[model samples]
Target: MRTYSLDDVYETRKRRDSWWTVYFVDPVACRVALPVANRTRMTPNGLTVLSLVLGMVSAACFAANHLIAGAGFFYLSFMIDCVDGKIARLKGTGTPFGLWLDYVGDRIRVVLCAGGLAYGQYALTGDVSYVVLGAAVAVLDLFRYVNAPQMKRVREAVREERQEPDLLADADPLLGPDPLLGPDPLLGPDPLLHPDPLTGPDPLPGQESERAGLGRTSRPRAFFRLFRRLNRFLARHRVRSHLVSGIEFHAAVFVIAPIAGAWALIPLAALSGLLLLANEVFLVYRMWLFTRRHGAGSPQESREHVLV
Candidate 1:
């Protein structure tokens, strides 16, 4: 209730929400933004829009081949991206609009930043490869986005089933005020720790059999056992993630891209394409596997299609 500069939003975040962000950009930004959050009229949605604007400007700078300036904006945008969530947590004014704003802003920023960098490189060097690379990144990025909401549901469902099976009758408990993560930060707002705000319609509730039993599946027990373990692994790991994580991709853009000079995106394109492909494949696999258990007529089957 005492929302003010005195609050250290970082203290309230989930451990898995942050790892590198906690180490690198956050401390300085938190010191600067906490007071602003207390004094300014900027809401979390405003911050989300601001971050997107900064990213666009940064991309413009990169397109013009201003590497250092682009990096400066990139980090600044990232820092503010972090700050918005802290403010949201501090003020406790998160809404679905703000959540969606934050999520869309992140996706747009990635497109602009990567595209701008590639175009700038091509402009400077007159190579079409950079242009191709940028396009490829965008395609992979789109593919990754399609599955984001689905993967999020799968993880949330799995996590909930393990913790409070009874409460899962309600739709994605986290989609509303998430008790597990606390106030959303940015996209994840939980920390890299953020939620992917791409929630689709919740899977329709089916009999208990849909979740764990396929009508005529060969081995219900073993199938569910493996399914739980796979889902658990995907949900728990911070590093690998299901795919489309920003850490490796961001590092490449901000670090490797600059260091490599004109060829920054060559490896980045490869990395992104592979990761997106893998993620889409896994998403499809999980959908098929889960739907099979739930049966074709079940609601989960229909819900999973929207995720695609």
Candidate 2:
């Protein structure tokens, strides 16, 4: 068996990650994962299961109105959650099942904790608003997770579409005409064989004449320039632009809110939810602008382009 130092565990940390994880969690998690990586025989899957169990215990504590203890357990569970991924990367024992288990476990923990905290508070004060707050937290978390992957796919597809013409042009001189479409009189002399100098190559689809300028209003352009600068600064620090992500949301609702007492939970959770929604909406708007500039067309067109 190989032994790993604290440095080795730190090396497994994600380069671009939420601010909460980078500053608050990684320092402690690396220290904990160090010994587990060196001496323990536990696998990543085992650690994930343990984390889930701790989360359950945290929820139970919340249910009993043990706010301080519940907050402690929730933080500990999240620390363990961070450690599982570190161990997986350090040992190269990661599996598809492990990823799925980690994701599902996270969702379950959020649901349970929300319900427990809300129920405990409602039971104590008889306010139904707590119940609604709990549902809002769970639903927002789920919606973010569900939409993220599809948005990622759309971004990737748009990028590929923008690059496709360049790819084909580069290959045409060496590969000649595609064999299946050997000669099409209707399409005229193959553009590859007899290129027109005056017109230049047909502009990349959806790009047309606006490829150079990106057809952006001055205000949006300036905003994006500032955004890029901010992104670059964040990247330098190995943090992501999304400062208030799902991880931060959970930390705020479960750890900070509980410590602040029942009165603070609803307000803190609401603020966190709003921040999360703002970040998501900003991302969606960026994607919309990107697709418009790149000529991604419709969802069906993007799918067809990707398939091709």
Candidate 3:
């Protein structure tokens, strides 16, 4: 993994090599070109707004049956989306407000894009397959939003509980004043969507409890216990933490499912949702532990000085 810094924010090539190159690399270069092309200059949010506009235009193109044009515009819009953050970070103006805007804008972009695709599908094939796909994507997008706080909670829990140096965790760019995990006041009443005052919940059903107790009873849970032990051994030997984001799980499902057909994708999507649910459940448990052990407080207050 590559480490990032405020200085590297403006350094196009450096950001390119970070594993997030999938999203940020080309977009940063493209947005950086905006200033070089005209000395008048463009702010990161301006770029983000421009990108949002372009994304809308691209959606329109898709709705108009200009599939290639729409795809091209969407691609560019995504690039700008990526660039704006890089610019913000580079310029040392990556505020929480900007972060919130970025997250909200991403949802809007996904909705519009999916709507356009659904419309385009109807216009072209006269079948609602594309529309259904679009709807599925829209649903997934919402699920993604709802999942953020839970994922953040889990990562925070891992950081607090895991006994390792966690250089990878420490080097994370999404930490400090602008943590990737924060209470999104905008997400509204969905308890799972944002951190709320923790309250205890009922224990898991008997089977899950039994599964968890397997090792306690016999020193091994199941066949997977060996792998878990091996993983622990590796982490202990290497002195690093294993923190996998659930987004990676969705990423794989998103790419694989659609190509595999509704039958395949639907189940994968369901499974992914289950994983997110499980992640959230774990987060709740973690929150309880954190609060009880270290004085209860609002999530914002707990990590006011830190980031995820």
Please name the candidate that would achieve the greatest TM-score relative to the true structure: 2
Better of 1 and 2 by lDDT: 2
| Top lDDT hit | 2
Candidate 1 lDDT over residue span 1-308, tens digit each: 34555446555333333334655666766785667766678888888888889998889988888887887788788888878877776666778777778878877888898799788888888888888877876666666565555555654554344443322221222235432222221123221222232221222567345544544553544454454444334436322233345444575565456656655458765775676577567556654554343343435644554355
TM-score of 1: 0.65
TM-score of each: 0.65, 0.80, 0.53
Task: Show where candidate 1 strays beyond 4 Å.
Answer: 1-7, 12-15, 18-22, 150-244, 294-308
Error of 2 at 163 (Å): 5.7
What ranges in model 3 sit over 4 Å off?
Answer: 1-20, 23-40, 154-308
lDDT of 2 by residue, 184-208 (tens): 1111133334332212343567754
Task: Please give the RMSD to the true structure for each candidate, in Å.
Answer: 8.8, 11.5, 10.9
**What's the candidate order when arranged by decreasing lDDT?**
2, 1, 3
**Global lDDT of each candidate:** 0.59, 0.74, 0.51
- In model 2, how large is the Cα lDDT of residue 65? 93
Worst 10 residues of 3 by lDDT: 183-192
